[model samples]
Target: MQTSVTFKNIDPSDHLKSYVQDKLNRFDRFLDNPAEASVVLSVEKFRHIAEVNITGDRLKINGREETNDMYSAIDMVMDKLEKQIKKNKEKIRERRGSRGAVKASPMVGFADTLAEEDAEGEIVVTTIDYKPMDAEEAVMQLDLIDDSFLVFTNAKTDEVNVVYRRNDGHYGLIQPIR
Candidate 1:
């Protein structure tokens, strides 16, 4: 792991730098690839803030904590980052299990195996139980959830429709044309 520490509104101290490096080294076992961490330690009046941003293979994590003591702030932020790393690793493991692992077949060439892997990424199928509701009701229901898109049966036409949030901050409705 590579780490860079920055101090803002506080004098740089070797003790603080070494302390953070040691704490970050403890997370090496949780990572598969070399990771770079950027840590910022700042002071605002009586508040001491510590923030760490870690970037590695397929992962980007950030943690920030503020307290009266700089040491405590560093410890708290490291704990938060560790928890997030563990949680993200578990989620990756779960996703891998859901998607069958790729194994090179005995008779298949290396190129063939690569093509198989690419095909696997083409489409993902998931089952969703859509509820029946009107278009207006669907829009209202979508607002109450965090999903980017929702599927609901249009009450008036009894047809399936999708209500989604657009990048332009507008709602889009997808209905099949008869």
Candidate 2:
């Protein structure tokens, strides 16, 4: 992976640049070929902040750390990035399942089959429950579970919604419309 290190409110140093590059290289295993990583180092009062941004195939991962020591901050940021990558991988796996097969079936036939199966199996054949909640509650649940996103039923619309944590330390919500 190619890396670019930028120093803000601080002079560029060879040691710091090399350290950032080395730490980011660890992500090479997670991506096919990372396009380029942008690392920003800045000093805020007594704290040194390190931010790493990586872009890959439809995936963008970012990590930031603030500490008194620049090297420690870099290390912490890299660790966070690794964790994010792992979480994303797990989510993708869960959605796709082990058998990565997509067979197109007519919606009408599929819905008919689903209704028949439900009637046959009074027992909950599949068990996934969604609670009615708002975006803030979904975010809290995500944080408590250490998951990237939480799926819940919207309290107002009674629709399924998803809330995820973004790289910029903000939340993103997705709602589907019929």
- Among the numbered candidates, top lDDT falls to 1
- Candidate 2: tens digits of C-alpha lDDT, residues 90-158: 787555543434321222111122233445547533334467776776666565455576667889899
Model 1 residue 1 distance off true place after TM-score fit, in angstroms: 0.8
| TM-scores of all predicted structures | 0.56, 0.54
Instruction: List residue ranges in candidate 2 displaced over 4 A.
Output: 98-178
lDDT of each: 0.83, 0.76
Q: Residue by residue across 7-86, what tens digits does model 1's lDDT show? A: 99999999999999999999998999999999999999999999999999689999999999999999999999999999
Compared with the true structure, the alpha-carbon lDDT of candidate 2 equals: 0.76
Model 1: runs farther than 4 Å from truth? 101-178
Query: Highest TM-score among the candidates is held by which one?
Result: 1
Query: Counting only residues 3 or more apart in sequence or on different chains, how many pairs clash (N, Cα, C under 3 Å) in candidate 2?
Result: 0
